[model samples]
Target: MNTFRLSKRIMNINRTEIADLIYNKIIENRSAIKTQFLKTNETVGYFFMDDLLPTELALEIHAKFPTTEEAVKRKNIREFKFTAFQMNNYNSLLEEVIYAFQDERIIQLISEICNLEAVYGDENLYAGGLSLMGKDNFLNPHLDNSHDKDRKRWRVLNLLYYVTPNWTLENGGNLEIWPEGLKKKQTTIESKFNRLVVMTTHQKSWHSVSKVLKDDVRCCVSNYYFSDTPFLNSDTFHITTFRGRSSEKIKDIFLRIDNGLRSNMRRLFKKGVRENPHQYKK
Candidate 1:
């Protein structure tokens, strides 16, 4: 099989090989990534690596991404995007890449760099998987739900891998980190093609994606790493909370109330009002 050739069906690429490539790249920039994360430890710790995968493989993945129309559309004030968690329904190669990050060695390396421990991967892809955003799609500044689907583990790190070739600054959908709370300035991380971003998820790690300025779809493969304990002693249970951008004052009020109500309900219900349908059933 010609590894460089593109086809209707992706050639079988071993996850171990993919993991090795990722490991090497992280190793290559270990100092910078580690320093970046450590310096921001008090706030939202993060670091990104460009050209995460080889150009050929990255383009192939982008070419195989299911269109926005084919995935789940989540349109509302809080966010507007499409997400796909059920990997069996997508290209086999997509599944391979998603699981490749879950490779034990990669997890350990990431854990070390972030000064975190016992970080484990989610096989079920709970709120973690393929997401695509086209024009006007935006994710508000928010904290991820504190725990995994079962509420047993604390979510510690977020992994985002971009495969959209030629994605640019003019293109919105870039990751925005509000390190000094939402009122202060925000740090924008371009969702550059073939880039992988890793960030610590704690109580103060508020982040969002800028609205897509172009008609093009910004594609990303996302995954989360959980730990046995919370990243900070102050971290506590909270649902996936979101707040409107500064311009939307009314929305900000509504969302805050909405968050409070949800938190109250969770206190009463414990597990939640019902099962969250976001996880991969298989």
Candidate 2:
């Protein structure tokens, strides 16, 4: 059921109202979130907040989210999921909410809370926008690509807003952050409804999505914020590296070799053998 649809007038404005909601929520919770990030800053700093929007709005967004058939299926031993970045092809409300997070005020506020500088939003929605995972879908532990599409800026942070109502830890498709590496125990952050999780992205941040254990399809809105320099001084450029879980001993080794080969390829080719087709073409 289409629970709600933005009226013509609501879609024409700057979406300041939703942006204000995001800004206010983050402002009210800024201190605690800052402390939380600090607590884990030595490794992979991250913090999450629930009820990020009005409950009814979140549910309405979920209802309008595109089905798996309407998305781009990305499946392989490394990962299995559906992603959509061409925001114009979907509900306009989704695009509005997405760019709302990009609002100048919200970006500045996030910078203040996360102690970051020179941050900017991606209007192209590079490797972001929407994600959906269903039964058996999973993303192996990996570090995001270090830089933006053109290698002009460092990809510093990832924002994920989930809207699936009644989602639970048991349903899987949760964010797993491996602060230490694949050998160490990782942290699982549930992808609950109306929750927004912000995580620092750079070297030592190996994270993934657990396989969906149930038939439910998990939907998420994602964005990445880039900066003029690395969030961590020690960080360097690399491809989107992936590794199998520790249990998959052989797959892990294969992935390691693959990562190395791909890293070398990037050094030689600069832009890779081909362009990544994950960004908004327009």
Candidate 3:
């Protein structure tokens, strides 16, 4: 679809009435939501809400997702998955649902629950969009890139909405957060259907996804919020750092050195040698 029409669809999705309804549902559970996030925020800073949207609507969005062949593949030691940000590549419903999280009311509610300030959603996507992982596909432990596309705002939080119906913990494409550190045991958050997970991302938040055990594809809609300040005083600019799992010692050492080299390159060239290709063109 054309950008003009796509923009209209996004706007329609955020019409005041609809936005208020979404806002109210979240606000009604605000106390519980805040408690859940605060309980973990001191360690890793994350929280999840099941049934973030109406199940039928969430299922419709998932049904509209592009197949693996239609999305871009990233298969390397760091991760193996499919991602797509170009809005035109998917149906209008997918675009609508993605931007729905960008709605100002929703943003305000999320910021309040997380006790974060000056949060802003990514419009160009900038590595925030749709992702899919089939059997054997996995993402290694890693920290997200520190800044926005322009290197202006700090990437503070990651918002992921899982819509694949009937997904379970045993399915294995769950989110793993290393609250204490990679050396310690990690917490597993199941990629449950129609769930929305919001997690803080700073210099030390190390997270990954377990390998998919089922033959099915797990699909997710992702978005990032940027801010003027780091989430913690200890936070600083860094590349998208990666590390091998606790079991892979050799790969861990190699990735540590690899991250150091990439960090150096960023220090010298603020924008890097080339532009990041993972962004919406319009």
Candidate 4:
């Protein structure tokens, strides 16, 4: 498929149309949305929306997602999932839809709803873009990295758009937000189709994904917004921190040690030993 034609057909100012749809939805429900975020932000700082986009459009985006073999696999204790940000490696439609969220209007509306200032979309897709979890894949509770790819701006918000049609709670692959800490019961957010979840990422905002129980895959388009200021006034810099569930005591100890070692390395080497190959080059 010609990249240009594919993008044109799928995106077709569809990027603008999607943004417009989101903007209008926000406008229509500004009071309710703001109230929801305000209440949740007091505890964990998060919000979610259902039927975020036209179901058919989201389904088309999901249909264009590359297979797990085409994405970078992270099969470590911290996580087991497939992610792809090298836009050229996938269909141009994927690239168009991903960048569409970066549109300024969408960014402004999101910032306003979240009561944030100076929020900026990441064009580089640092740790953003597309994510897939198949059977047994899971992400341990963790705090996102404190900054952008260059470590210049503070990572403040995480935007995840789930598009796997007919996904259910029993299917697993749901997002778990640890508002009070891992020892307490965490809030489980179902990864339903056409749902968009936005959460604040700070020093204490811990979150993870449940293991996929079924053979089917859970697909999502992700994006992060950064700002010049931290989400919390007391927020300090740190690497992406991970923690084991409450039941996994030994795993928790080991993960703490691992996080300590990585944090120390980042302290000595701002950019770490090597660059993270998770960004779009072009």
Candidate 1 least-lDDT 10 residues: 1-10
Model 1 Cα lDDT, one tens digit per residue, 1-282: 234442323467767878988999999999999988889888999999898887888998888889987899999768999998888888988988999999999999999999988889999999998999999999999999999988999999999999898999889999999999999999999999999999989888999999999989999999999999999999989898999888889999999998999999999998899988788888
Q: Give the runs in model 1 whose Cα sits over 4 Å from its true position.
A: 1-10
Give each model's whole-structure lDDT: 0.91, 0.90, 0.87, 0.89
lDDT of 2 by residue, 1-282 (tens): 122533333444345777977888898888888898899988999999988877767776788799999999999778999998898899888888889999999988888778899999998888899999999999999999999999999999999999999999999999999988889999999999999999999988999999899999999999999999999999989899999997899998999999999999998999989999899887
Candidate that scores best on lDDT: 1
Query: What TM-score against the true fold does each predicted structure earn?
Result: 0.96, 0.94, 0.93, 0.95
Model 1 C-alpha lDDT versus the unseen true structure: 0.91
What number of backbone clashes does candidate 3 have, counting pairs of residues 3 or more apart or in separate chains? 1
Candidate 2: residue pairs that collide: none
Q: Per-residue lDDT tens digits of candidate 4, residues 3-25?
A: 35545565554566667666776
Q: Residue 180 error for model 1, in Å?
A: 0.3
> Candidate 2: lDDT over CA atoms?
0.90
RMSD of 4: 3.5
The model with the greater lDDT, 1 or 3, is: 1
